[model samples]
Each structure stands twice: as C-alpha cells, then as structure tokens.
Target: MSAQKVLKLSDLKQDAAVRVVIDDIPIAVVLDSNGEVHAIGDTCTHGDISLSDGFVEGETLECWAHGSAFSLRTGRPLNLPAYEPVPVYEVTIDGDDILIDPHVTKEVN
Candidate 1:
C-alpha cells in the first residue's frame, strides 16, 4: 500500500507520542528530542493500553499501565512484562508532512 499522510511534522512535540489510526491500524507517532520521527504499533503487548498515552524516554516509549518500554526504532520491548515487539513502520517526511504505510514495517534485527 502507498504511504498516507498521517500528520504534519510540526504537529508532533519533541519527546512525546501521538496516536494515529491509518486504515484501522493504530500507530504511535513520535518525534524524539533528537528531532527524529518514528512510527510504531500503539498497543502495549503487556496490556490492553495505548502506548501513545505512555511516556517517551529517549528512544523508548514506556507503557503507562505496565511500565514496559518499547523501542521507537525497532519496536522491541526494552524492559520486562512485554516480550513481544510491536511493529515499527517507516516514516517518510515530505516537507512538513509525515507519511506512513501501515502495511509496511521496518525489518528489525
């Protein structure tokens, strides 16, 4: 599927996460303090909670309910309670637009 414009780059705040649903696929869009944009699955593997409602620490998004931190780059859980890694979508920055394809995800090693 082609990438869809989810939000404007200026719409994101540094070190925070926003929830966006594209084609019924929920995703968490984050703009780190380093000024890099990342897209990952919004659901917490440990619980039925929105990762976007959680905290952003460095390159990880911590689940508010279980305190499981998921990597923004790889979507891997950095801590316990969540061994499953979430999907990480590739983010395309076109000027101020943030594009993402929900069907396309980055290969994490």
Candidate 2:
C-alpha cells in the first residue's frame, strides 16, 4: 500500500504530538525538539493509553499512564513497565504535508 497523507506540516508545532488514524491504525505524529518528524503507534504497550497524550523528550515518547518511554525512531520501549515495542511507521515529508505508511516500520533490534 502507498503512504497516506496524514497531516499538514504547518499544523504540527514543535515538541507537540498529534493523533491520526490511517487504515484503522491509531498513530502519533510527533514533531520533536530537534524539528524532526516521527510516526509511532499511539497506544502505549504497558497500559491502555495514548502516547500522544504523553510527553516528548528528544526522540522518545513517554507513556502518560505508566511512564514507559518508547523510541520514536525504532519504536522500542526504552523504559520499564513496557517490554513490548509498538509499531513505528515510515514517515514521508511531501512539500508541506506529512505522509505515513502504516505497513512499513523500522526494524527493532
């Protein structure tokens, strides 16, 4: 499947996260502190919480419920309370739009 245009680049502010649904999957589109964009699974692995409601520290998104930190790039859980990694989607920046492919993910190692 092709990448779907999820959001406009201008709508996403720095150090903020937005929840978007594509292909029935909930995704969290984040603009980190370094001005880089990332797309990760919105659901926190440890708890039934939205990661977009959590905090963004650098490249990691912390779960608001249990404080599990997930890597934005690899989707690997960095902290405790969550051992499983969430899905990380491939993000494509097209002009002023943010495109995301839910089928593609960065390999977690």
Candidate 3:
C-alpha cells in the first residue's frame, strides 16, 4: 500500500482544505494555522460526520457532528462524546501536490 497521490499545496490559502481517498480510506487534508498541511481521518469518532465538512482550527480538526475536535497531527480526540481518537495520516508535499498516506494507524492516546 505505497500508492501516493498529489492533492494540493501549501502556498494556496489559509482556509484551504481538500478531501481525498487513498487505499480506501477517507482523509481530509487541510492547511492549519501554522501553514502546514495536515491529514486526518474524515470520519468523526463522536458520531458519523465527515470532518472535512467541519471547521479546522490550528492543527485540530473540529468535528461538526458533536463538536469533537481531533488533532491533525496526533489524531487525539479533544472533546466530549468522542473519547476515541481518529486516525491521522502522514502528509508530504511534492511541489504543489499534497500526498496523503491513507492507511494510517488508528492508535490514539
């Protein structure tokens, strides 16, 4: 499972977010407040809402389903109703393309 696809770049805008699926995993690639591209699981652990549709603040992706925010880097659930952490994927920028590792480990602490 070493397939990689270019999604977007980091020189675009501050509120830029892209939703992509790789290796059958849904991921939301977003540029955080630190101007770094981060990848997180699209599904919210609190419910079944897509995190891509939620608000992304800093490195934490807020789940609109239950307001459960998860860290884009560590995938740690930071809100209520979602004690479980979502998955975070590795992101690499190739020129202007954002490559996301879809098969991320679901280990959250």
Candidate 4:
C-alpha cells in the first residue's frame, strides 16, 4: 500500500474541506463537524462541481452545484441528482501529519 502524506492536521480547520491532488487524483479532505477526518473524491458524481467548495454538515458534504449531499464515510450520495457513489479513501493520522492512500479505497455498497 502506497500512502502519501497529504497535509498536516493543523492545516485543516474543524468542519472544513480542502481539495488535494495525489498521483493525479483529486481528493477532498474533510474535517467533519465531529472533529474527525475523512477523505473522498472531490468531484460530485452528478455534476462537475468540487465537493470541497460545498458545505459540510456533520458527516455529509453537500455539492454546491446541485445540492447533492454525500456521506463522508462511504462517499454515497444521500440526496437526489446523484445515484452513484464517489470514491472514498483511507486516511491515516500519524502524529500531526495526515496520510492518504489514493490507491486504497474504502468499499461502499
């Protein structure tokens, strides 16, 4: 498993999202409202809008373009306009650093 260091924990604020690229993959690193970190595909499945540009409530990240809400843990769209789920990555926190494995995705059903 090739895991890359994405960002520092201090670089992300609580309840915010950041767009990152790793090995040509656009990822959305989200600091959820519960103070937990999650990593998922930045692109919305229904639209081309970036998920990082949307609002995050609890564990759901809403797409700003079409108001599609996706779950941070599973990448599954909880609302309409998007039936397909995005890719969810595995995040590892090492001390103050945040590591992400772009090749490794958390399976969502």
Candidate 5:
C-alpha cells in the first residue's frame, strides 16, 4: 500500500478541518477543540458535501453543507441525514508532523 503525504501538524489550526488526499482517498483532517487530530473520509454520508469543509466541535465534526455530525475518532454518524459511518484513519504524531495511515485497521504506531 502507498501512503500519501497529507499535511503538517503545524499547518492545522485547532477546531479546523483540512482536505487531503491519501492513497487516492479523499480524507478530512480535523483538529478537535481539545487540540486532538482526527482523520476521516471526506465524503459526507448524508450528502455529497465534503467533510473537510465542516466544523469541528469538540470530538465531533459537523458537515458544513448539512447539519449532520460525525465522531472524529470512530467516524460514527452522530446526527440525522447520515446513518452510515464513514471510514476513519489511524493517526500518529511524529514530532510536529501528523501522519495518517488510511489502510490500517489497527491503532496507529
């Protein structure tokens, strides 16, 4: 599997989302309210809206185009309009850099 370079941790602001392409998969990199980073599929299960343009509230990422909210950690849909869970990636902190493994099923190393 080929891992793709997404972004640096320093480039992400707290409570913000960034769109990135990893392994040809469009992913949303979110920095939660508590300064935690999460990686999830960019596609919104409710609509075609990109989750990267959404709002980060606490551990949930709210879709900007709709009202649906999702858990950044588990990719679970937390609100209406979306019942299916999106794919979540494993994240690792390498110094000041943030690394993501989109194909991994286990905890990030």
Candidate 6:
C-alpha cells in the first residue's frame, strides 16, 4: 500500500510520542523538540511494550518498562536489554498532515 495519512502535525505535542496503527502495524509518531517529525515501530525490541508510552529524550524514545532508549532516527537501542533495533518508517508532511507507510522503512544498517 502507498503512504497514508496517520495524523495531523498540529495534533502532535512537541517531544511527545503518539501511537498510530497502519495496516495492523503499530507505529510511534514523534514531534521532537527540534521541530522534526519521526516515525518508528511502536513496539520495543527488548520488551513487547509500546514505545509511545515511553518518554522522549532528545532524539531518543526511552522505553518505560526497562529503560531502554531507542533512537528516533535510526531506531537503534542505545541501552542494555535491547540490543535489537526497531523499524524506522519514513515520514512525510503535507500541510498539517503526517503520512507514514507501514511497509516502508528507512535503511538502518
């Protein structure tokens, strides 16, 4: 499927993560303090917890359960207990809308 509108940019709070599901895929959409938008897999690789429920630290999203921080850009875990990186999706902005395609992810290697 092509890119779909997940939410409006205005609806997002700065440095906060908003969880959106597209095609049964859970994604965490974040509007960082730098006024940049990011989209990553909502599920934490270390635990099955939702990353949206975690805290946003700079450009990283910290999992609330185990304190594992995942990079908003590369989706790599920067802490212990989460050696695996999550998927990072490409974000598109049109007017006030944020679009994300679940199947499309940025190369992390």
lDDT of each: 0.96, 0.92, 0.75, 0.93, 0.84, 0.96
Error of 4 at 106 (Å): 0.7
**Which tens-of-lDDT digit does each residue in 5-70 have in candidate 1?**
999999999999999999999999999989999999999998979999999989999999989999
lDDT of 5 by residue, 1-109 (tens): 6444568889999999999887677889988878888888899999988998888889988898878999888888998989988888878877877887778743422
Model 3 regions lying over 4 Å from their true place: 10-12, 104-109
Q: TM-score rank, highest first? A: 1, 6, 4, 2, 5, 3
lDDT of 3 at 5: 70
lDDT of 3 by residue, 1-109 (tens): 6538756574446755567777667887888778888777788887888888888877788877688888887888887978887777777777787766576454544
Highest-scoring model, TM-score: 1
| Backbone clashes in model 1 | 0
TM-score for every candidate vs. truth? 0.98, 0.95, 0.85, 0.96, 0.89, 0.98
Better by TM-score, candidate 5 or 3: 5
lDDT of 4 by residue, 1-109 (tens): 6899999999998888999999889999999878899999999999888999999999999999999999999999999999999999999999999999999999866
Candidate 2 has an lDDT of: 0.92
Model 4 segments beyond 4 Å from truth? none
Give the per-residue Cα lDDT of candidate 4 at 59: 94
Worst 10 residues of 4 by lDDT: 100-109
The candidate with the higher TM-score, 4 or 5, is 4
lDDT score for residue 48 of model 6:
97
TM-score of 3: 0.85
